[model samples]
Target: MKNLFLCSSFFDVAGILPNFLERINSNCIQTVSFIDIASHVEEYKEYVEKAKLAFEQQSLKLEVIDFNQSSDDIVQQLQKNDLIYISGGNTFYLLQMLNEKKLTNVIVDLINYGKPYIGESAGSVLLSENIEYIKKMDNPQNAPNLKNYKSLNIIDFYPVPHFENQPFKNLVEQVISEYGESLPLIAFDNKQALWVLDKTIILKDET
Candidate 1:
């Protein structure tokens, strides 16, 4: 049961599920979207509902799980899930919550178990070994940092999501400069994608 790490700025693609769904056991192909841990519990509920609507519109079968739940509780929910989607939000906050909940290890096990994964925005970026390339809120914005926020290491290098979108290009350049030329950094514009196969990665249009 090999896994494919499908990366996207968003998962609005209608056929996205079927493409990989057919490859894995139906029961194993589950979808979980990670929301911004920075938001209040009430606000996060709204976010999850909207996400559910989007997936429903596509007629995709996704069992949404709120990672903000108690750390011990998350493992039970994740035991059988296949695809865990991480939505865009504060990258550092997301990692902080993940570490606090101890859900990262469960995620690693799920991926190793051949459960496919998809991420958008913060979700996509958090999988990299380091998300230092991402820009945080400055004087105008309030962002939280939980110690040294490192990513899940699901991918070998850093990921630059939302390229061609505001402020992203600037940070990407900085990341490249800091990491040097040999790093396997991936940068994609909105409506573009990085598709994962057993042992290969392909870029495709959002449609």
Candidate 2:
């Protein structure tokens, strides 16, 4: 069964994370594989620090993994962790690194095997079958080496993170207005999340 918690912003929904973990009977999670390769800029680095603190508050030891610098074994690193967290950043860059490192299949297999996976923003979008839908919201120029917009394909519906939220509000609306009829978009705000448990899916609101 696939256990996925897709969120617009991890900090926005961090308080309710424990409840979700409880619902999935994963309260015992101790170690997490924090994938923050998407956050390459100085500004995003600050957000990553807060994300690390969030995990620390839950008493979850995090093994931060950066595909850009680390030469470690991806499969072994992920397999050793109790949970997998993909932070928010440039969607194109994130996909480019994952594709370059060939970690997409590894992550998909682990999640399918029941490993709890948490995705924030870009992370959430990467689970969709194709990431081309988010081109308007995220700059594709960040990933010049990307061969295609294909993604993990773990979920059938396209996730529109930060829906109706600032900065991305207009962009999100544009994406919906253009792809609403052509794509299966599951749009949600920062305080909401898309929970996927096996074949059952639910849109959870923290408001």
lDDT of 2 by residue, 114-199 (tens): 99999999999999999999988989999999999989999989999999899889999999999999999999998998899988
List the candidates' TM-scores in order.
0.76, 0.95
Q: Which parts of model 1 are misplaced by more than 4 Å? A: 5-8, 11-14, 23-50, 61-63, 136-145, 167-182
Candidate of highest lDDT:
2
Per-residue error for 136 in candidate 1, Å, reads 5.8
Instruction: Give Cα distance to truth, residue 179, candidate 1, Å.
Output: 4.0
The parts of candidate 2 lying over 4 Å away from their true place are: 41-43, 68-72
* lDDT for 183 (candidate 2): 99
Tell me the lDDT of model 2 at 131. Answer: 94
Query: Candidates' lDDT values, in order?
Result: 0.60, 0.89
* Per-residue accuracy of model 1 over 64-124 as CA lDDT, tens digit each: 5666567666776666554666666666667777777888878877776766676666677
